[model samples]
Target: MLPFFTNPYPDELLYSAIARYHFYSGNLDCKDTLEELFGSRSVIPSVEIGSNFTILAEKLGHQYSVESLLTNHTIYPYYASFLSKQRQQEILENVKGDGQGLYTRLGIVAGGICRKDGLYYCSTCAKADAECYGEPYIHREHQLQGIDYCSHHEIPLRKYPKTNDSRIEYIRFELKHMDLSPLYEIDSHKELAIHLAKQAYKLLNLPLHYLSREQINSKYRTLLREYNLITSSNRVRQQEMYQAIKSTLPNSFLQRYESAVNNNDEYNWLRILTRNLKRHVHPFRHLLFLYFLQYSVEKLVDIDEDDGAFGRGPFSCLNKAAAHYKKFIISNVIVTRDFKTKNLIGTFTCSCGFIYSRKHTTDMFEIGRIKAFGDVWLEKLHDLQQQNLSIRAIARELGVDFKTVKRYLIGNVEIKQVKSHRDNDDILGIYKQDLLKEIKKHPNLSRTALRNKYKKQYMYLYRYDKVWLDEALPERRYGQNTIKKVNWAKRDQQYVQEINRLHQKLLQSEKPIRITISKIGKSLGTLANLEQHLNKLPKTNKLLNDIVESVKDFQLRRCYKIIDDLLENDQEIFLWQIQRKAAIKSHHFHAIQPMLESYIEMKQEVTNNERTTS
Candidate 1:
């Protein structure tokens, strides 16, 4: 084994420790360090989550294991807490191995939250680190993807310079890269940023798989109901929720982290967070939503699923026969929605076996119906009958009507004559006659029209005489049925033609718009068809796969267009001027800066050569 290794500082990344190891070990090449630690020089050191930890644990001796390093050193727990237990286990196994599909599994690559291009460190933390350890090192908390400030000091984090070959090199904090000066100029929305940073830090410290996606969704629904953002119909007021969240977060802060809410975009993170639970959402977006709800991460997880629609339980039992009447002893409540009215219906069950339902059309609790009076009420009725009380008196005692008391007494008769089956046939015959008469009067009426006109007769006949009802109704004509097989081949050709025209139009437009399949499909009014059935449209599918552009490409196109306009007007060009005209965000522009500079230089050279020739 090697001579010794540096113990990781609190919240220090395992990758950062390895970089420190490389320095102190005096290895001439990083490959030698990698070989010594992992027994494989080909291992790629990742900033957020490194691979081959099982081997590294062996090299680190007894003090470090794969689990300990993964828990305290890496940022895996932040994502793990929101993922399924099964998925967390799979990710843990991946971390133990070469960590293939690790980031993709964690949803980092597709999470839509932009990660920092390089390492980040708070300047104050760096100074303190240097003083304490005689050298500064990267902290895991500072490197979180969307967190801008240090939670401890509440100061903005400065990004460290990235190595030329990050795939092969592990960067440790260096004094040359450190700046000790305090930043007096504060960013806008400092309070919101600090809150988000603090929440993110809490998530980083949470245990593995602390909360499942279902639990998170339940908590959000509870809060949304309390905020009165849920409609009476049980649907989330998505537009209002989006507006509220937008108002809480400044647009600049959102744009900086690439978490901006677009009202027109139906699949935005806020909408998805409210509805879909299967998809793994980034923890940073979760923090934004929590901030909107004004809940800390700890409190949010602790909030139980006491859906506010029915309010918290220990609801009053409506059983009048029992001594516990109107007392809050009924702890079990089952909430469901009315199919026809879309109103929430709460079914409260008592331990005494009485069950009653109430529809939450309003705050008042009016009994919609009593499902079961149970044995307690039944025994109470028998006792009142033994006292020889009148039907009305017993009804008053039992909290039921006289007709209900009489019906129950008659229903309890031990030896009653059974009614003949033909007694029900007589009722069915009356309904059947009415249906035939209606059909005879309106010969041209289809089944639907007939059903609507004579709904009661239609329903009675439908339930009891379904065979006869089907025979009596008009036969379904061609193309009347709902399920019609599509001629996919012909439709595919038509869509391909329409999409090709739209694609050309998009390309030739003066404004630089990102070429995405969704954009093309939405323009064609076939977004759903394209998204779900594109594989069947082979030509369209291939074309979309080839033509779609990344956001960076679209930014480049906008930048080049601005440069061309400047050249055409014979105006002097500058990087800041190009960026302002392009309207691309600063951080995003930084990615394409080198290419933009080269393009401007090339254009200048062409102009100079033309002037010389002239």
Candidate 2:
């Protein structure tokens, strides 16, 4: 039936665009489209009216006459660009001659990496400075084939020449190492997926109509099992039962529908479906059928059945029954990690128009529980400790906590764990060693990177938020410890920083080390003599060992002396200071160390005495 009409566009192009849309939806009804266009506030009116626009207004709303569509001025700009010489050249070179298939023809991997054309790779290139630079060539792959050299390095492509076959093999070899799902090993997850599919079927189908409890059980026997939500079974018994019940429902049931006008014509399908559901089934009860349907259709298949295509009037009341199933499929399914907090989240909406949402927190939650649960408990305890306002009063004002506030602050609360100040993918030892080297050179680097570097021995660490430190300095517990605090403290910045770097070498190390004071002063970088430096060693050998054994040896043993005159002023001379070196703490130091001169002589004397005794 013709609904309404309106002239909404000014140009031929605009009318043509509307025609194309009608063609796509298979709807020639211009009335509905015009009605929607007129109803919206933001849709703007076209500039001027022409014959094309007039024809669009009067038509069956089919696309502009096919003849007019072939030559529209609106698309000329894009087509015009194709005529350019440069563009034509590019098209010629890139376009394939014999089209295998548009999709299969163009590929990133099939053409690019499979061919073994010799190419430059920075990682495998000659690293000039490292000892391996001149060493015998070691192939990154197939080392048994010996040095696989690229031509760019001025080296001959090894005994094995680079070939397309080799390149394709390499591509496949590299691809084989990709991490893939271990689903093949887990049987339970797949079983659960199947069970959920059957559940989807129940949720999607039940809204056909509502019935009383006794009628539902006697007529639809399986409805009771579905109603209780006992869905863990590997099988669905309700499909057969529901089909039987639906077939037996009498036509007189339409009399139960509330709408009086819809008795003969102008049927309100949604209203009738709701009426049946209210009378015979659980409200929103079709959600079970929807879940089951979702579960059964494996990842590849989609359900497109339209049970409610025709209104329930004279025949096919079952189709009339299944109409109101759309609303149950509202939210997209969210699958979260096992941890309550997500390391990853998978969100999906299936093609069946049925939404299955669940939060799955994987093992990461267990790890967080280990690290964060204690802190969370402490936070609860602290909140409980502070009781200036009554919990009820606080809840009234802030809208959240009476007990929760107390729990997070006073009881079993998780602490706000500062993530470990380390990078997971950092070049491991290289990063730390490089940072120590940087600090040695640029000890007073004001803007050095704090993200990956730490200053050792003699650095003054100050971030923009200026709680400052230089060599074993005491940090202030109160505010104003960072750069933000120090900018205003014209005089205190230097002094506060001096105190902060004081304990840079705080951790105790297990290795014994010998400090050659004479050689250390050889560079004589600063003006200290061997005697002056050695004089700073601790009074007892144990004290000296403790000082020297620390990870930061030189600074801790003597640097503290300069800080508070920790050394009581006996600035004499000496050759060297000796302390144990760091090695695997699992073994005795002597057991692992090379025999010393003193140990060798002791061993020789013991051997002679053993011989005499024998």
Candidate 3:
């Protein structure tokens, strides 16, 4: 063992501590020092060092487990909360064995390491470290990828000039040895950078417990529901959720982290988070989601065992007269299952007679629909009335309508209940005779026609007097005997003639007009009828099919034409010009790129040969 080894600084990486040890001990040879500390010289030092914790502990004459190093020094806590106990164990085993192989599988580099390209350090921390410990050291938080600022100081982190690309294997470079450049603080990104830094710091420093994938998924779903990003049946409003996330995070921050969700992509990280937890996501991505959802690390990791139908309650009482008004003591939660919609309706009630309900799926809750205020809320108007306050004044004070204040003042504050279908049966019975007379007067009229004339009566009869209504207005039968026959042969000949005329017109047109079925069909409104009788209109079908072009074929033809025109005009044959003229989407340009290139080469060769002959 070495004569002396320094204990790791607060939030300092194990590798950084080892590097500091080498600096203090005047150990110039990196391979030898690594062999002495880790019992093997084959180990490569990474930003997040692992595997040799036990060996290092043994060399230092101390007892320490791999978990202690991971928790106290590395960025394990950020990922630990999202991983299952088994997965966490696997990570520990991988780190203890190969060290670097598990990072990719764990999604650490999923977003790609574009922003964090070097060894970063906070200048303030570097100066403080030099002053206090007589030498500057590398901080664990500073080394975290995508973290650009110091969480404590809120200053931009500076990167070492050549430490990241140093040729010396396992180089023990301290902060004092390198020339640190000052990082300019971007005002707009400062807040976001600080937030990211703080979150990253928490992950590196905190001792977070392991949470299962199911637990994390549940939390995300709950947040989505609360944000109204999901429907009653638990279907995600993808567009809305996308828009919400876009609006929540700044474009610069997203671009910096490479976590921006594209509008056209069907699958994105946000959507992936909502899916089943079979795959592990990157810890940075988890942080992004948690930040977007406004969930702190503590809230995310702490799974509430009592999250039942009414567990979210102790919801504020809506009834103003109740002693526990807005005190969140109300616990009357009734869950009603709607068989037709397959929806669960949760009705929350208070002792003071205020009630509210929401429709949700079996596993989800519509928290946004949880209305605490009820008719009892109007009781506040009573106090205003006693004070002789104007309706407008009361309305403004309570943030309600003046009309509502007036109604409550007149003692018309009773809550209105919705009338059920059964309750309307009596009213329908009164109009039964009138509905029958109207149907008889228009016996030739169809059910839809009759319903239009007597909408309310027809709806009631359709629901209650179905048998009578069906008898009075029987289903219309258009059998061969009753139906008007069409001479399809004659219609087919006429359509063929029209199609020929249109085709001739298209051929005669001088401009580059696209000949599509829809364009021809629009000119001939009876094309839908012709399409229906394609078997009988074989001549017309053949004529239309001859001119029809698939989208790819049409785009390629247009592209060729555009290139030919450009060549004839002696203009530059640019890809953008071809794309714009052909109306081809940018994504499809690559598919036909080789063909275009070959054609361009051949045309240029022919032109050169003609020029040489001339």
Candidate 4:
């Protein structure tokens, strides 16, 4: 068995511990140390080194498994919670079998790499480690990309340079052996840097389970709804949410992490987060969203099915006389009904026998209606009443309505009666006789005109006095002296004569114009009338149909005319020039290409024979 170090630091990574072991054991070569520990020499170490936990545990003679080492030291815990169950198991198997090769499979590289140039180490942490443990090592938290400062110390980390060649397999974290760069203070965005660092630190050290995609999506939607970043029907307010997220995170931080979505891109990551997540998102993205929403990892990971639904409850108990008075244990829920009207009811009940309900379509409650005030509130009201305080005054003192004070004085605890439509009908009855007299005075007037003239009376009568109003008002008559009948046969003959005249006039023109239905109808100024009587105007229809040409035929005719013009001018005929002059598109020329080719061949042969005879 290989001798390994005991008492590793709380934040020490597995790679750092192994590197320390290599140092303490006087091993000079990293490749040799890896070969001895993992029983393989094909391993390549990256900044985010992983997958050697089981091998290390076995070699160190420890009883703990790979899961323990990963949860305590690596950043896998943060990413694992956002991955699927199958993915989490796959990650564990890969880590136990292969060292430093699971980042791609785990989707950590999906957002592109944002790590610093080389190895990072906090000067304060290194000094503390050397003073306490006799040596300093690389911290896994500081090694994470986009984390500029140490989470604990809130100080900028220093970088260590390395060769660009891949020949260097693994570097041991020795403060004296490495060339450490000078540290610089973070001039701007110090608070943002520190906050992100602390969150990353928490993620690295905390032990969390894989949160289902559904769970994460639910948590995000809940936050969006709370912020009014989504519509009631669950469509995301993309523009608003995008602006809010952009304003919340610094531009430099977003650019560094590659999380900045452009304003014009419709299918950005923020939109995808609100939609059904079809694939696993990177952990950094999840952390970025959590940070923007002002939520910690603990809160996000602890979200349950009961949470982010209906209302965030442990609502205050209104029953003051009960043992749990004023305690937040009551639950306000929305009870849905199948009917359209009165479909929802908000119910609030305490375990102490006090119940209050309000009919509302939403789940929100009226705080003043929580009548759970116990005997103490009643006693105060009673004292005030005895001291000659008015109902309004007593209600103002107790922070309740005058009706509530009156109810308490009357010793009645029943719920107040809700107003119904019948009351409105009584109010409308006052104007019933006047409306009837007006309708009788103008019997020929249309119902719509009368209703508009007396809108309120008509609406009330339409709702409550349907039978009487229908009988009193005249019938809604259509086609009353408005529409006139026409002899279609005579009109058809007139249209045919007009079309023929227009066509003859076009034929006599200096430039022949195409005879079309629109042209004929427009000349006669009866386009609408001709269209309306088209079925009866068979002669006109037949004449127009005979003149219509297919697109290919029209293009061929135009090309022939161009060729005739070119021949008469004794100009050299070019196919491209002919097509351009004819205004024929490429597809049209292709359709009548055989005729064009034959004409070109005939013209070429005649020219060749003339040259021979000459």
lDDT of each: 0.83, 0.29, 0.69, 0.68
> What's the residue-level lDDT of 465 in candidate 1?
85
Cα lDDT, model 4, residue 245: 89
For residues 208-289, could you state the per-residue lDDT of candidate 3 as single tens digits? 4556566777777767766766554456678887788888898877876777777775557767677764455666777888
Best by TM-score: 1
Which residue runs does candidate 2 get wrong by more than 4 Å? Answer: 1-64, 67-335, 339-387, 395-401, 418-614
TM-score per candidate, in order? Answer: 0.63, 0.14, 0.56, 0.52
lDDT of 2 at 195: 39
Q: Model 4 segments beyond 4 Å from truth?
A: 5-7, 24-31, 99-101, 164-168, 177-182, 210-214, 298-614
Badly placed stretches (over 4 Å) of model 3 are 1-4, 22-29, 52-61, 112-115, 164-168, 175-183, 210-213, 221-230, 235-237, 277-282, 288-295, 298-309, 312-442, 447-614
In the range 1-614, model 1's lDDT, one tens digit per residue, is 56789889989998899899999888879999999999998998788888888988988888888889998999887777677667888888998999999987888866747667888889999999999998999899888877888899988888787564757787878988778776645566787788888998898888767787767887888888777677655679898887788788878988888888888877777788888556667898888888878899889878887466877676988889998888888776777767786566788777777788887555434677877787787888899999999999999988888998998888963322223476678778888888788778888778888889889888988898899999989886555676888988898889878878887899789777788978987888899988999878888788777788888888998898899889989998899888877877789999999999999999889988999999
- Model 4, span 1-614: residue lDDT tens: 57556545867777667656667667777777778877776666544547666777787676666777777767676566666666677788888876444875666654434746677788778877878887777678887767788888777887765433554345556667544344667467788778878887777765656565666777777776556664433466788888888789887778767777777765666666667755456666677888889988777667554243345676665553445656778765534322454223445666554555544334343442453554456667788899998899888776677997898799888643323466776666676776878878887889889888888888878888788888878788777777787887777777777777776677566433555666677878987866676777777677667764556655665676667667667778888787767767788787787898787677668767887999
Arrange candidates, best lDDT first: 1, 3, 4, 2
lDDT measured at residue 302 in model 3 versus the true structure, 0 to 100? 65
lDDT, model 1, position 384: 94
Q: Which 10 residues in a row give candidate 2 its minimum summed lDDT?
A: 312-321
Ranking of models by TM-score: 1, 3, 4, 2
Model 3 lDDT, full chain set: 0.69
Q: What are the per-model C-alpha RMSD values against the true structure?
A: 11.2, 35.5, 12.8, 16.4
